[model samples]
Target: MNYTLHQLQIFLKITQLKSITKASEELHLTQPAVSIQLKKFQDQFPIPLTEVTGRKLYITDFGKEIAKAAERIINEVYAINYKTMAFQGEITGLLKIAVVSTGKYVMPYFLAEFMKRNEGVELAMEVTNKARVVRSLELNEVDFALVSVLPKKLKINTVPLMPNSLFLVGSEKLEFAKNATRKKIFENLPLIYREQGSATRNAMERFITKNKLSIRKKIELMSNEAVKQAVVSGLGFSIMPLIGIKNELKNEDLHITPIKGLPIHTTWNLVWLKSKKLSPAAAAYLEFVKTNKKDLITKSFDWVKHYDKERMLVKK
Candidate 1:
């Protein structure tokens, strides 16, 4: 069929979202514009690629197969562009990483300089929970994953980047008596938590179990931002990563309520599956991180240590 790459792209986006209107929004095209392109793409095939029954749109089995081919063609086109840029001695290609939700805050700072130095490169990152990040590694879907911990079942290589520390945080509106105990914080406020399979949630669970701490009530949210917002609104307290709440803590929207065994520390690591071969862009990024991470951390991450020191002054 004589079809343009843009048609394949629109079809693929429609298949993924299962809604033409949503695809149009994602592609930054008007609904009518997307509809015209989709209709033009479908005209080339005798059999229907997509079918609509009432309100829902469905891609046929034939459409699913075509979507796979479209992805391969898109990758090939990208590879050609990257190869041409490399001939001119530039590090080029898409560097895709799947990061745990809280890692979104940490990875961007590391990426900013690398991206600036290599103008030919492009970035794609999926910020999700730990389980999805690990699944992406298993599928070889991404070049790297940023996590504070990796599952023992996965054989992977790791590059330790910086410390990831979690603290028990509450809304600044929380008030305590002059001699209030740490246990009182738990008693006074409901606990907000990230959903299951989140590394933060797992760590919080371990701490609670070991200390035999009783949570009076809890609210489960799916993301770090959600939990933080809940805590900021005085709905509850949560065990949140220090990196993700620096600004909130500074603005006095949240407070690191000093819990006895808190500020659990782990090293944030960049990991990739051992069996997956690295692309040139991925390899270049690996080298850059290895060479510059120490200096980068010192320059940009001094706030973490400074915050820790200041937190110590919040007594029992």
Candidate 2:
């Protein structure tokens, strides 16, 4: 039985996401279309490739083996294409990257520069939550992933790209805006926090535990934008990436509360699996980031300079 590469790619996505609808969304195919292709591909094999229990999908043991083979086939095909392009002295191919949601703010700036330099390159970027981004990395689905916090569970190589400091921000109208201590802020204010699985949330939790701060009243939101809006409307304070609040700070829509021992400094990293072989484009990008990370970070996040000035004043 012959299976097209496209079908294999679709099946790979399905296995990774464990849902037809999610795979279809990622592939930009209708669910029925994806299901039909998946069914046709499964028909080629006598044993079932996947099984569904209740609402969740599970890949059978045979499916796991097929998935591994599919990955090898995909990677080798890409490697050969890259070799051919290199032989022709061409700097052109697909550059797929997955970035944590907060990274979306700065990554496009660098991608724009990269694209400008390599006009023949095709770029695909997925802006997803950290959990999905990590899952994508685990599945070797992207050349690189941008994250603020490194996943301790994954054996990967990482390059520090820039600083990703977290700041406590709230509506400017709040009485405790200027000089609230960590305990004071946590004990009195209603804090708005990102959903449980977000990298931002994880960082915030670690900082809270380290500082022994307890949030008394809190509102949980799923997205950074939601948390920011909630804070703007005086719903609560939020710990947000400094990169994400440049506009709000400039417009005075929000104010950074200089709580003592605050503004947790973290670094954004470009990460990839240590064992996977890199494509030419990915290798070039890794080299480019290595050589130009400092300048790129400054260029993408120049507003941080102003924040630094504010932090200095807050200290005084």
Candidate 3:
């Protein structure tokens, strides 16, 4: 049976999202358009590829196997395209990375110049919580991972890239704006948190346990943006990476709450497992960062250094 590559792409997306509506949104296609194509693709097969049970769609075991083959075919096609570009004397390949959610703010700046310089290279960055980012790196699913908090029990090499600082932040209009003690601030504001397995959440937990302070855990959000929105809405305060809340801080939507021990400092690092071999694009980026990290920081991350002055409020 002959099926178009477009159908295979749509089917793979369906396997990932598990809902036609969701897959359609991801593919930027209308729901009816996806449904019609899915039905056509199913007609070419004898057995059912997907089944709707209890009102939720589930891919059959056979469908999962087919999707795997589909993925390989799609990747092969991409390789052929890249190979043609390489034959033309251009640097071309996938440069895949997995980064923790807070890293979104810093990774883009680091990549901008590299991407500009190597216009033929393709970039795929997966932004997720720390656990998944580490898992992707551990499983060799990506060429590199960006992290502020290093993982334990993982043998890896890292190149330090940029400064990452976390501070207790609240709405600018937070009550008792000035002269509040550390414990008193905790008493006043319930702390919003990133969900479990998040680097920021882990940092917050370590701080609480180390200080032996009773923090009211107001709510848990899955992303940095969500936590920021909660804080800006006066729902609660959160410890956030300064890189992410820069705009909010500038707009007077949020402020750093200078506590006794805060503005937790960590450097962002590009990490890769020692055993994994790097592709051309990956190696290029690694070399680019190593050679130009200082210049990159000066150009794209000058504002990050301004937060060092905030460090004086808490001391080293």
Candidate 4:
């Protein structure tokens, strides 16, 4: 089939997002424009590539093969462009990343710094739970994924980026804040939990189970921001990543409830499928991350310390 690389790009995006509307938005093309290209691409093949059942889109087996091929072609094109740019002593290409929801606190700063250094690089990011991020990596929809918990089901390459410290957080006004060390305090306190399937939730659950902490009442929220807001309103105590709640604690909007066996420690990891070929941009990101990990973690810790000091001074 005679098809342009642009058509393959659109088709791959449609498969990744599973929606023409979302692909259009991501590609900065109108819905009709995306639809026209998709139709043209589909017409070249004898059998239909995709089928829509209700609002859900399903790629046929042939379509899946095409998408896999398209991804390889697209990455190879990027690799070629990267090699050409390297000859001129420049780094330029697209960098796609998928980050777990809790990574929102850290990934943006990293991206901002990396982008500043490599002005020619374009970025696309998706922030979701571990499940979706793992799926994206498996499908080659993202070049890398940032997460605290590695996917056990996949054979992936992992680089440890930093420590993810989780603590029990609550509004300072809560009675439990003053006596969080007491098991009864935890036994009596209502708990807010991250949604099921979340890495944060999984980690917290494992810790709680290991410590045998009894959560009297529990409610689940989907995002870290949501959980923080809920805790800020004194809805209940929740285990939160220290990075995510740094701002709230600094502003005195939240308090760390120092229960025993506190600060569940997990490693923040950069993961990708071992089988996927790394394009230049992706390889650069990996190297940048490897070389700069200490600085990134140090900067984050420094900020946390500054915030803690300021908050303590205010408390006095």
Per-model TM values vs. the true structure: 0.83, 0.70, 0.81, 0.69
Model 1 pairs in collision: none
Give the C-alpha miss distance for residue 128 in model 1, angstroms: 2.8
Supply the TM-score for candidate 2.
0.70
Model 3 scores a C-alpha lDDT of 0.87
RMSD of each: 3.1, 6.5, 3.5, 6.3
lDDT of 2: 0.85
**What lDDT tens digits, residue by residue, belong to model 1 across residues 235-316?**
8888999999889978989987776887899889999999979988899999999999988998888889886776464444
Report the number of clashing residue pairs per model: 0, 0, 0, 0
lDDT of each: 0.89, 0.85, 0.87, 0.84
Off by over 4 Å in 1: 1-3, 30-32, 39-49, 61-69, 119-124, 135-141, 153-155, 172-178, 273-276, 298-302, 311-315
Candidate that scores best on lDDT: 1
Scored by TM-score, the top model is 1
Give the winner by lDDT: 1 or 2.
1
TM-score of model 1 relative to the true fold?
A: 0.83
- Candidate 4 local lDDT, 1-316, one digit each (tens): 7999999999999999989999999999999999999999999999889999998889999999999999999999987877787788888888999999999888886777788888768899999998889889888898999989888888999988777888777886666444335467668888888887799899888987887767789899989899889999988888889889877887889877655566778888888899989877788888898888788778756676543333221110
In candidate 1, residue 2 scores what lDDT?
Answer: 89
